[model samples]
Target: MSELFENYLACWNETDPTARRALIERHWSEDATYVDPLADVRGHEALDATIGAVQAQFPGFVFTPAGPVDAHHRQARFTWGLGPAGAEPLIVGFDVVVTGTDGRIETVLGFLDRGPG
Candidate 1:
């Protein structure tokens, strides 16, 4: 489960479109959906684009796990922090992920725990 969350954060950190898309394809279901306070999107293309947008908006920042992942029965929850290397996080979030029967992410429900005003 931790590896899954690590891959999830890696997807957010990857800037190369090809690499990111590959990560998404390997870890996420084709019809996966993601919803958060600011965005709601479904499918691989939209997910890729959304991640790209975040990368563009916060260039050089990286996403890291804030704590251990807790998972049970194909569901997992974790917290994440985003910021420049060696600096305190500027944005923090929590996400709950549901994996499909194939063990790929089927859906993600996200919440912003801390963000710029």
Candidate 2:
């Protein structure tokens, strides 16, 4: 796994909004695309908005990794906290992010898995 992949996951696990936004800004390109259940966003502003919406909706949400990261493809599967700790995490999705040559994410395809939980 590349350092970026690990760092990206670490950033995803971050709860602080400011820190999380900073991480996204640092790792993703200005023209990055974020595809989630809510919407497909292009550019930093949209990305910020998507994160903001999720933050607003989830409240105490936190993403917990559920499987091995496929760093070669810049992909990962993770479960997320819908409310607080100890509650069953919702298996949000497997995210496949493609990075540009500059090591910034160019696009992300999020596939939601609602199975079993």
Candidate 3:
């Protein structure tokens, strides 16, 4: 699970579009469903659009994991960040649930802790 998470972060950090897309193709299942704060996408095609949308909104983003990386029941949770250094991360302690078997991610659900002021 840690390996997968590590690979995910690495792929995300990669600047090249081809490389990132390849990583996504390799790790994500064909029918994978990706759920985030704003979008719920299914399949690689949809996932591609979802990624584009996210990148459009948060360019040069990365996930800053906080605490342990647990993959029990095919799910994992960690923190994520957007923007450059010294900027307060838009989200903290974000939860990501990846649904799949044998480490092949079939679905991902993300949750952000952003409460009212």
For every model shown, the clashing-pair count is 0, 0, 0
| Model 3, TM vs. native | 0.77
The TM-scores, one per candidate, come to 0.97, 0.76, 0.77
Ranking by TM-score: 1, 3, 2
Compute the lDDT of residue 45 as modeled in candidate 1: 99
From the highest lDDT down, the ranking of the candidates is 1, 2, 3
Q: Which regions of candidate 1 deviate over 4 angstroms? A: none
| Model 3 C-alpha lDDT per residue in residues 69-113, reported as the tens digit of each score | 766777876655554446666655465757567676786777767
Candidate 1 C-alpha lDDT tens digits along 1-117: 998898899899999999999999999999999999988999999999999999999999999889889999999999999999778899999999999899999999999999965
Best by TM-score: 1
Candidate 2 TM-score to native: 0.76
List candidate 3 stretches off by more than 4 Å.
85-88, 115-117
- Top lDDT hit: 1
Clashing pairs in 1: none
* Residue 28 in model 2: lDDT: 88
CA error at residue 26 for candidate 3, angstroms = 0.8
